[model samples]
Target: MDWEVHQNPERLVKTFPFANFREALAFAHRVGELAEAKGHHPRLTVEWGRVTVEWWTHSAGGITEKDREMARLTDLLLG
Candidate 1:
């Protein structure tokens, strides 16, 4: 997971694989809940058995430490 940190747009990309669409949506929902709890939301895309999450701090105009935190949280949720 190189996940090269960038300066502009403020986002990091991560992809998760599920056995099926239902599992993917379930994981996405969990991420949404976590985002609400942290007050930091991420953009998500669900396709078939894969879900892609992008985290960015809009106010900072770039990726922040919070983004990585949320990314880890997301991984935990999926796990």
Candidate 2:
């Protein structure tokens, strides 16, 4: 229901589940395209039935509104 916040290097992470690898991979690709368009990329781990996305701001030195917005946009990808 919410993102997993990480410490050390601050980040907002979430996991999207799917029935198969193709679905997850497709979702990851969409995120990649979105990242390219926004010029803000996240760490994406595409597995057999899920994709984990982590967003954070490097220049800002922490999690910022941009990271949250990217996570929001990522949710929009499903809608």
Model 1 — TM-score against the truth? 0.87
lDDT of 2 by residue, 1-79 (tens): 3889998799999999999999999999999999999999999999999999999999987799999999999999987
TM-score of 2: 0.94
**Model 1, range 27-72, lDDT digits (tens) per residue?**
9999999999999998899988999889998888888898888887
How many residue-pair clashes does candidate 2 contain?
Answer: 0
- Give candidate 1's total backbone clashes: 2
Name the regions of candidate 1 deviating beyond 4 angstroms: 1-8
- Give the candidate number with the greatest TM-score: 2
The residue-level lDDT of candidate 2 at 36 comes to 99
Positional deviation of residue 34's Cα in model 2 after best superposition, in angstroms: 0.6
In angstroms, give how far residue 59 of model 2 lies from its true place: 1.6
Query: Whole-model lDDT, candidate 2?
Result: 0.94
